[model samples]
Target: MRSAKLESMIPAIDVRNLKKSYLPINRRAGGKTIALKGIDLTIKSGEFYGLLGPNGAGKTTTIGIITGLVRLDEGSVSVMGKDIISDYRFTRSKIGVSPQELTVDWFFTIERLLYFQAGYYGIRKEEVSDRIEQLLKKFGLYKKRNSKIRELSGGMKRRFQIVKALVHDPEILILDEPTAGIDVELRHMLWDYLRQLHKEGKTILLTTHYIDEAELLCERVGIINEGTIVVEGKPSELIQSLGKGSIEVYLSDCDPEKEALISGFSYVLEPYDGGSRLVFSVDEPEKSLSEIIKALSSNGCHIHEVKITKSSLEDVFISLTGRAIND
Candidate 1:
């Protein structure tokens, strides 16, 4: 019953067979670089979805195509059952994007900036002032309504970008690195507010370098690489796929015999600090740890220390991507 009810609601964003490429201005002959290669994905209504990838991973291109900023070279994109190409006017209205760049006009006051945005969407004059005030209060910016964008702190400026996006009352909000430059406290505050918004039934598509933030807020995540999606699942599920936990063993002596025994058990064993440290993943930590310790002791290997820890989203990313997000 629940699955059927959920399916009854149209997806907020859908892209299929998406392909985009760019040609360098100086080198027109065979200098084309593909951004998105036959990508297919969907974000359902009222879901907080995270899109994560390294730089040059087609994340920006995907967002650009959906927001109607970049024209797609192939495939189709739809928002709320409306095709972006055929019904872009209506599709764009349903989405509000907060880009990574500070693209707002710093000359305008907080109040006027929001009003200007609402005006672009053709919001009624009578409804404009009241709606702006309400959104400002919601984002803790009502007191700075008359303050110019330059006067506000970086955190406040970031919050205003969100308020400006919401001024249009969009059904789906797309935030690209929304909390990039903000401090930890402000990030947590914004997280709480975003959770409240999600509870109110707003669909969100977030692309961020902060893996921890994605793990905390998003229900599902899609990790893209080399112009294609490599993995898609809930954060917990993805981390679970790596293993139950990780075990780091520090040996007193570096022995090839001991190294071979540890390597035999784990597919992902790394030697750190001159082969004395052996880090590997295990499916059952309790059973595996006992077995590993026994094998080492029986083999005349001296074990100095052992530490078992749970796998994190970062570990999963590194395992899959073969590199870090910042790389």
Candidate 2:
């Protein structure tokens, strides 16, 4: 530990050149399907961090390793200044994990599930009862306390999983797509609860496909692709680092000639007039719009509407990794 002060202190989660590989099938390949390749990251205490990547991009593998569900072939993980392997009990005790898989015991009622989870953390009987009540209310699962796991809706069950993970009030929280399949209202409600927890000084690491969620909730974000980090920084910082500000042009008519003109510029890439829209980007839109309009007019086309939008977390992810966040 360096210092307790917020300015200089140990991170809640630290991963150093972490690597995990699936064993190769005989006669198929020389090496394994490396799930992680030297992933190095540090998430400060009390920070809301996002882990983002496309499918099979190692997001879940990284989560499994940190939560002790999957063993890593190399590298180290630390939670709250304790090495995960050497201080396994203490490290595990300090962290809460809600995995993506739905594995609830069908027979366990909501209340019993949370109560048993609390007992696993050695919470006293009285305190366990008190905490379960509070968690149920916080997650909007209070009304379903007596309901069996199989009886709860998907959203309610998701909330129960979160409440179960938080039975111990762990200092760190890991949520893997906690809002997936949830309606907008429930998703926002869950976001509010997570925000409140973060305000109470809980470090959070979340993996989500929702770009807007990542942009709104995460202070810092790490984007991994092909088992390596392509970008890591404050969300705003990463967004501002994009080369071209995105521009979407809606037209009353199609014009390939004008679209080609815009695409010729090294800065205005991904230009396509497919399906009745000329969409592209410009490094300096304010200065280049006039030139673009001229080119369009020369091809007997006119812009019906043009909008310059700021880069989003999704944009930054694609710009860095060359793939959409959900891909």
Best by lDDT: 1
Tens digit of lDDT per residue, candidate 1, span 1-327? 997686547788999999999987678466789999988989999999999989899998999999999889999999988899889889988999998898656587889888788888888767888888888998889999999988888999899999988989998999988988889999999999889889988999999998999999999999988899989999988987763686788775546344556555773445556556666667656668887887776766678789998777787788889999988
Clashing pairs in 2: none
Could you give candidate 2's per-residue lDDT for residues 29-128 as a string of tens digits? Answer: 6777988999998999889999988888898999888888889889999887888888988988988988888766867787987777888887877887
RMSD of each: 5.0, 5.8
| Whole-model lDDT, model 2 | 0.81
Task: Write down the lDDT that model 1 would get.
Answer: 0.85
Per-prediction TM-score to the true structure, in the order listed: 0.81, 0.80
Q: What is the lDDT of residue 296 in candidate 1?
A: 71
Please give the distance, in angstroms, between residue 310's alpha carbon in candidate 1 and its true position after superposition.
1.5
- What residue pairs clash in candidate 1, if any at all? none
lDDT values, one for every candidate: 0.85, 0.81
